[model samples]
Target: FEEINDELIYKKDFDIDTIKYAILSKLNPKYLGLSPEVIILEL
Candidate 1:
């Protein structure tokens, strides 16, 4: 993800949706059950 951030910063515009999808797709299943409060705090 750091690599992605560095590459995106080099480019003009960053696609936030792509980053969100990438994070969601790669997150561990154990983390998928986080409560809304935890999720908000993590974000």
Candidate 2:
């Protein structure tokens, strides 16, 4: 997982849901170009 910058957390209008979505989106199989099964196997 990627780390969010401290600057982003300190933003005045930051929303928890938005940050969660951003992190979840990166975990999508299409983004990593790997199948879910392969990901689980590696883990």
Candidate 3:
């Protein structure tokens, strides 16, 4: 996201929890007007 410079990663594993958290972080924030595009910076 260019607007806020959003960043995320999965260091060891790409499990459900990691994906869930990433989605929630982007979608559940109140300040943001719309859901941010989820990004995986590294694996």
Candidate 1 has an lDDT of 0.53
Better structure of 2 and 3 per lDDT = 3
Per-model lDDT: 0.53, 0.50, 0.59
Runs with alpha carbons beyond 4 Å of true place in candidate 3: 1-13, 29-43
TM-score of each: 0.37, 0.36, 0.33
lDDT of 3: 0.59
Show how many residue pairs clash in every candidate, following the order shown: 0, 0, 0
Instruction: Give the worst 10-residue stretch by lDDT in candidate 1.
Output: 34-43
Q: Give candidate 2's whole-model lDDT.
A: 0.50
Best by lDDT: 3
Sorting all predicted structures by TM-score, with the top scorer first, yields: 1, 2, 3
Residue-wise lDDT of candidate 3 within 1-43, one digit each (tens)? Answer: 2234465543554586678576776664775555455555655
Clash pairs for candidate 3 = none
Report the lDDT tens digits of candidate 1 across residue range 1-43. Answer: 2356457434436566665666677767675765412232223
Give the CA lDDT, 0 to 100, for residue 20 in model 1.
66
Task: Show pairs that collide, candidate 1.
Answer: none
